[model samples]
Target: MAELQIAEIPYEDGGIRYRYARRLSEDGTRWIRDGRFTAYHPNGAIASEGTYSDGIEQGLWRDYHDNGRIAAEGQYDRGQESGVWRYWDSDGRDVNG
Candidate 1:
């Protein structure tokens, strides 16, 4: 099996600033970035994922719990939350809107 590929930039405070990953294409090409961005938790679980434009977060972004369940989900405009947002518990129950 082929291993997944990821490229990451770190913040000055030792957190991730941005990250990009390789994904297989419809035509079988390996592409990096491809619009989706991800950050990892200290335990290596996905902390958040969303689209970016010019280094700013855009579109839908989802944050996850340490147990791997979605904790919150919402849309973003230039790294700011925009539109209606929702929150969920680790058991997948909607806790907020």
Candidate 2:
């Protein structure tokens, strides 16, 4: 199996930033973003966490508010959302129904 390779640089835009890492194809022609990923708010606090496979988002994912509170949680299947999803307020109250 190929080992995961991190992006050469971090992505930043609109006060958000994140990094992506993935494995390189045997031909080295394509760099896929696989493994763990995280995004941060402008204040440098973590805004989200998730996993990806073959360049597509997968598995459990969590997004947080700028104040360090979880804003949402759910599962993903190859970048498509799957299973139950929940949302929370900045105060940490579950608002998902």
Instruction: Compose the digit string of candidate 2's lDDT tens values, residues 23-97.
Output: 988788988878888888778788899998888999999999999999999999879999999999999999986
The reply for model 1, stretches above 4 Å from the true place, is 1-6, 9-18, 21-34
> Which candidate's lDDT is highest?
2
Q: Candidate 1 has what TM-score?
A: 0.62
Q: Model 2: clashing residue pairs? A: 5-22
Total backbone collisions for each predicted model: 0, 1
lDDT of each: 0.76, 0.85
* Every model's TM-score: 0.62, 0.82
Quote model 2's TM-score: 0.82
